[model samples]
Target chain A: MSNKKVTGKVWKFGSDINTDLVIPNFAIYMTREEQPAHCFVANRPGWVDEVQPGDILIAGTNFGVGSGRPIGDVFVDLGVFAVVAESFNGLGLRNCVNAGLASLPCKGILDAFDEGDIAEVDWGTGEVRNLTKGTTLTGQALPPEIQSIVEEGGVMAKLKKEGFVS
Target chain B: MGMNAIEKILAKRSGQTVVKPGDVVMVDVDTAVSFDYGKPNIKKIHNPDMLVLLHDHVVPSPTLSAANGAKSLREFVAKFGIKNYFPVGRHGISHVLVAEEGLALPGNILVNGDSHTCSSGALNCLARGMGPSEMTYIICKGKTWYIVGPTTKIVLEGTLSEGVFPRDVIHYIAGQHGDFAGRNLEWYGPGLEAIGMDGRLTMATISAELSVEFSLFPYDKVLADYLDGRAKKPFEPSFPDDDAVYDQVITINLSEIEPQVVLPNKVAWNSKPISEVVGKHVDQAFIGSCANGRLSDFAIAAQVVKGKKVAEGTRFIITPGSQEVMRQAVKAGYVETLLEAGAVVTNSTCGACYGGHMGLLADGEVCITASTRNFKGRMGSAEAEIYMGSPATVAASAIAGVIADPRVALKVKELA
Candidate 1:
C-alpha cells in the first residue's frame, strides 16, 4: 500500500442516495470536475461548497443504484476523501474502486458519529475510525485483488503501475 | 472441456491465455462511451476518439433544469475537443443511435456508461454497460477484467404467430427463464434468420433485464444483408467454433407460445394469461425505452391503437427510445395514430423509465410498461405498481384499459 491515510470530516446522509441523484441524469455528459459541482445538487443544495477536501460522505443502503453513471467520480473530483455507506449497489461499488476513492461499508459508523466530526480511513485495512468520536467501526475489508487496485490509486493507475498498458 | 460461444469470443478478442465460464479476465474493449454524466472524468482521462457522448435523458424534457444541464454539457464537449458528442435534441437514445448509425460492428466488444448499453448487442456484438470510473479506467488503460460467462444456447424456432413479435418472445423467455436463470442466452438455429434486425434488437436488449452477463447471435446472412445496405463495407459472419459446448441450452418454439405478458415484479410467470387480466383497471400505459422503443415497436403500437382510444381512467404515454426512431416513426405515420388514439408522444429520451422527468405514476396507480426495470419507485411513486411487456402488449393494454394480451388485437389489426 501507499501508506496514505485518508482523513476527512464526516458528512452524513440518509438511505439510498442513488447514482442518478448523486450526479443527476442531466449532468452525466460533463467532465469529472464539472459534474461534481452538481453533486447532490437536487437533494442537499449547496453540497459542493460545503464539501471540503478530505471530507467523507456517509450514507445508508442501496447507495448508487440507478444508471451507475460515474457519480462516484464526482465525489473524488470534489475532493471527498472517502465514502462510507451501509450497503451499495453493484455498479456503484465498481465505480468507487475505479475512481480511486476509498469507499467502505461500515453501517454502524453512521450511528456512532455525527456530521462535521473528523474520520480517518485506512484504505489498506478497511478500518474507518472516527477521530472526533474516538471509535472504530469494523467491516469486511476489500479483498486482496480489489485492494491491489486501490493501492495503485484506482484501476487505470493500477493497470499502468503494473505495466499492463501505457 | 470446450468453451462456450461467449468464452471463445471474449478469449479471442482479449488475446487471453485462458478463457472459461465465470472466469474474470481483463480484456481490451473495442468501444468505450460516456456522456454529460461522464464529463468530469472525460477531462481526467483526456481521450475522446474512443468515446461517444449522448444527451437523451434530461435534455428537451419537461424540466428546464434538465434542458439547461444538457446545454452546459454541449459547451463542455466543445471545450474538451471530443468529436463524438451528440448534442441536445440531436442524437437519440445512446443505444439506438449506436445501432442505427452503424457504430456497432460484428465481433467487437462494446462498453458504455449506461446500464442498458447491452442494447448494442443486437448487432451481434458483445456489448455491456459500465460506470464512469470503469469507463475512465478502460480509456486510460484500454482494458478491464470481464467475468467471461459460459454460454447458454437459446434457440427461438418457428415463425411468429400473428401479433406475436420480438417483445413477446422476450416476455416469454423472461417468463420461462426468469432473470439470471441462464448464464448466457444466444439466439441460434434457422429461426434466427426469420426475425428482422429491429425485432432482433428488441430481444437482445432485454438480456440485461434478465441479468445475464451476455447475449449474442451468430452473424448470419440476415445481419450481413442488413449492414450491407446501410454501410458500404463487405461483412463476414462470426459464430462459435463447431467444437464449442454450451454450459446450458434452452429451446423455445415461438409457435407454442401464445402472445404473452410478464406480470408485475417478475419476468417469468405464465400461470395466468392475458385473458385473465382483460377487465383489470390500469392507471397508466407506457410504450418506449431501449428495450422496446424502436421504429418497429412504434409501428406495432400504432397498428394496435388505430381508430381506438385508450380506456377511460388510463393514461397512455409513448417516448421513442431515440431521435432517429422518433423521426422515422413520425414519417411512418405511427405518431399521428398514437395522438389520434389519445396517447401522448414524448421525445426520444429515457423520460418515464428513469423516473425523473416524464410520465411519472402517482401513488396506488398501476402501469404497464415497455421499458426495462419494474423495481420500486423506478418510474416515480414508490407505491405504484408496474408490469413490463412488449410494445404490442403495452399498446393493447392501453386500448383495453388493462393488461390485455396482444394476440386478438394483433390479428384484428392485421385484418383491418
Candidate 2:
C-alpha cells in the first residue's frame, strides 16, 4: 500500500447520513459525470459547488445507510480523498472502497472537528489528525488485501493490471 | 472450535476444513447475479456458467439513459452467449428471481449487485451483496475475496400472535438490537417451524436494512420441499454444530411482538407500535418488493381487503415479486380480490421501491410501503414520508387512508 497522506477540509454530518442524501434519487439516471453536479442536491443544496477536490467528509454513525446505489462515485468523481465516520453501512463501505476512496471508521472523530476544520489522514497507518483542533486520533487500518486493492486504484484496476480481465 | 453455517460455507468454498472470523479467504462463488446497472462496468465475461443477468431495476426503461443501458446489456448478454438471462417481463426483482428459480442453492456462496441479495440466505445459502466492480471481477474470475465475519445467533422462541407477521419480528429485532453491521445473523430455534420459507425470506431480505451482510437459516424439510426439483443440483445441506461459537446471541420472543411500523427516513432503530402511527394520513400504499412481494404477502393483503373498498384519496398499488408469484396470485384469486378493492396491481419489477419508475411519490406525500427501505427520497421526493410495515398493515391502511392496524380493521370490516 502507498504511504500517501490525505489532507483536506472537513464536512461534518450527523448520524444516519443515507446514500440518498449523498446523491439524490433523481441523479441515479444521470451519467456518472453528470451525477457529481447533483451531489447532495436535496440535503445540502450547492454542496457540489462548495466542495473542492480532496476534501474530507466526517459523519456520525450509520453513514451511507441506504441502497447501494453507487453514490460513492459522486465522491470519487468530485475527487474526495478520504471519508471519516463513526461507522459505515456495509454495502456503502464496499462501494467507497470500490470507488478508490479511503474510508476510515474512527470512533468520536465527529466530536474532534467542526465543519471547515482542516484534517490530515494517513491511510497507511490509520493516523487521523485534526490540524485545526490540534488533536489526533487513530482510525482502523485497512486490511492488507483491501489496502492493496485501494492502492491499485480499486478492484477493477488491480484486476486489469494482473491480466485477470480484458 | 465448531464453526457456524457461514463459516462452514466459506470454508468449503475456499477448500479449507476450518475457518474463523476475520480470516480473509478467496471463495469460489456458486452463483453470481448482475443487473443492467452493472453492465457498464463489466468489460468482459470470463465465466458464463456461474453468472445470471437480469433486467429488473428499471424495467421497461424509465428514461433514455436506462433504455440505452438495457439495450447495451442485452447486446452484451447476446455477445457473450450468457445462458441464464432474464429480460424485462421474463423476471421480477433479481433477488426474488434468484430464490424462486433455485439459482442459489443450499450450502452455496452467492453474490449479487443489489444489497437485498441477502434474501437468498433463506435457502441456507451464504449470500451477500457486492459492489458493481466486485461483481464484475467475480464474473471474470469466478471468485472474490471476503473477510469471514463473526456470526450473531438470533434465537426466536414462542409463536407469533395474531396480526404479528414475520415483518414485525424483523422490525422488532432492528428496533431492539440495532443494525448487525458487518456480522452474519444466524436465525434458529422453534420459531422456524412457524415462519416457513416465505417468512424466512422476508426476514433475510430485510436483514440488509439492518446493515447485515448475510442472514442465514439452517436447512430443514420446509426448505427442501420448497427447493424440490428447483435446485441447480443436489447438494448436501449445512448447519452450525450444536457447540458452534457465536460472537453474540440475541433471543427474541416472537409472541411479544406487536404489529410494528418503521417510521419515516430510517429502517432500523426508529420503529414504533402501529397504534402510535395510526390516523396519520397516507396518500399511497404499496405492497411489494423482494421483502414482501411473495404470494403469501398477497394472500394476507387480500384477506384483509377482501370486500372493502380502497379510500378515494389514496392510491394502492400491488406488484408481485415474480411472474410465478403473479400467476399464483391470479390462480389463488388474490389478484381479483385486490382489484375488487380498487388496488392497481402491476407487473413484477423493483421500480416503485427504488423510485426508478411507477408509483413515485410527490412532495409532502406520505406512503406506507412493504418494501425494505424508508430512507429520505427512497420513493421519490425528499419531502415525502415513507412508513415501512407488513403487507397486512399496508392493505389495512390503504382502505383507511391512514396508518391503521390490520387486526382492528378486520374486526371493523367483520362488524360492517
Candidate 3:
C-alpha cells in the first residue's frame, strides 16, 4: 500500500466493454497467459500487442457489464496499472478487486483525458488528475476493509494468509 | 424505517436489527453453486452440504479444457465431500438445476459463478451472480459481502395475452426502460399468479440482461405449490412489509403486451414487438438455454409445429436445459411432435446456446433464438445475426423459414 498513486499513459475505451470482449469464450479455454493476447480482439484486433505494461485505462459507464469472466485477470496479465470507469457493473467491480487490481469509478473521466494522455491517480487521496488536460476529478475508492483485502493481494491471498483457505 | 425484501434478508442474515441501502454487510449464503465453465480453485469448502457443483457449460466434453473442467469437479467432489454433484448426462444448467432440485428456497441467499443465477430470485431468494474469486471466498467462508442498493417496485396487472410469453415480457421491460444497473427489482401484482414458475423463472433470468442484480418474485401459493414435495430442505418465506420503502415504482399491464423480439446483438436499446420484425428470413431457429429450456418451452414449441414440416433449409435446434426437463418433455410426448416436424432435438447441455458446439451458426446466417443472449459473436460467427424471441415464435419461424407469429400457426392456445 506504500505506492498509492499510479501515473501512466491512458488507454481509453467506451461503455460496456464486457468480459466477453476482453477474453472471448474460445480464448478462455487457452491458458490465462495466452488469453490476454486475444484481449479486445473483437473491437481492436491485435490491440493486446500494443498495451504497454504500465498503461492505464479510462472507460465510460457500465464497463465490464456482461458475463462473470475474470476480466481483471486479463488486465492484470496485460500489466495494466489501473482502471478508471465512469461506472462499473457490480460483478465487474468485485472481479477486479478480487484479482487485486485497482479499479476506480470516476465520473466525468472522459473529459479529463483523451486516449494516450498521461494521468496520475492517487487512490489514497481519491484524486484523478489528467496531466495533459490540467484537470482533476474525484474517484470513488474502496472502503477501508475492502481496500485492506486489495492490499493483502486479493481475497484468496488474504484467506490463505489467515489460514481460512489452503 | 421499513425495509424492502432484500434489506430484510440482508439484515436477518447479517444479524442486524435493520439495514438500509448502501449498507455493506457480510451475509451468510444458503447455497453456493458453481458450474464447469469457470470452476473455482478452492482448497476447502466451509460446508460441503451447502455447495452445489455441476458440469453444464459443455457437457460430454466438446474440448480439452471443458473435459478437464468436468474432470476436475470429480476431484473437487471427493476432496470437499460434496454430495450434490451433477456430472455429464445427469446435469443441467446450474440455474435450472438449482430450481428443479428444490435447492432454491424462499428467504435464503444463493450465490453462483454464473451471471444468470439471479433467475432463482423467482423463488423469493436473495440470489445474485458473483465472480469466481468472490464465489471462492463464499465457498470457503460461507459468506459474502453485499452493498445493498435501493429497490424498484414493479407492479404487474391484467392477464398475459395469448402468444405472449415471459421472454417477451422481459424484452418489453428492457426495451422501455434501459438498464437497471446496481439496483434490485421486486415484482408483485394481480398478474403474478398466472405467470407460473416457468414463466417467472424466464422473466427473472432475462432480467439479468438489464444488469439488474436481483429480479425477485414474491413467495406466493404458486411457488409454495411448486415446492410442496420438491424442496431439498425446510424453508420459510419473506415478504416485504406493507410499509416498505422503494426508490421507484413501475407498473406494467400484462394484457397489453405483445410478443417482443430483440434484434440481433443487444436488449437494452434493441427490443421490438413481433410485428416490427416479421417476415425476416432465418437460416437457423434455436429453442433452449437456461432462460426458456424448460418443459413448458418444449410444449409450446411442439404445439406451434404440430403436424407441420420444418422450413426446407432452416435448421431447427432444441437443447433442453437439463436431464430432468428432457425426461419430463419426453414423457409428455412433446419431443416426438418436435422430432416428427424435422426439429433436431439435442441432449440437455448448454452447447449451442453458449456457442460451444452442437449447432453453431455459419457466417451470413440468421437465427431466431429463444435463448439467453443474442449478442454479436454470441452464437458462433461474429457476422451471424441472432434474433431472440419466445420459443413459440422461434418454432413458428423455423416452420415458415422466416420469423413468423405463433398466434397464426397455433390451432389452439395451450398454457404450460
Instruction: Supply candidate 1's per-residue lDDT for B270.
Output: 32
lDDT string, candidate 1, B132-217, tens digits: 55776676666777655556788767888776777778777766665542256677976777898888887887766665666787
Interface RMSD for model 2 amounts to 2.1
Greater-DockQ candidate between 2 and 3 = 2
What fnat does each of the candidate structures reach?
A: 0.26, 0.52, 0.49
Among all windows of ten consecutive residues in candidate 2 chain A, which has the lowest summed lDDT?
A64-73
Pairs of residues clashing in candidate 3:
none
Candidate number of the best DockQ: 2
Cα-based lDDT for every prediction: 0.72, 0.86, 0.85
* Candidate 1 lDDT tens digits, A56-82: 888875566546567667787888878
Ranking by DockQ: 2, 3, 1
- Judging by TM-score, tell me the better candidate of 1 and 3: 3
lDDT of 3 at A146: 62
Q: What is the TM-score of model 3 when looking only at chain B? A: 0.97
Off by over 4 Å in 2: A162-166, B37-43, B413-416
Q: What is the TM-score of chain B alone in each candidate?
A: 0.92, 0.97, 0.97
lDDT for residue B42 in candidate 3, whole number 0-100: 62
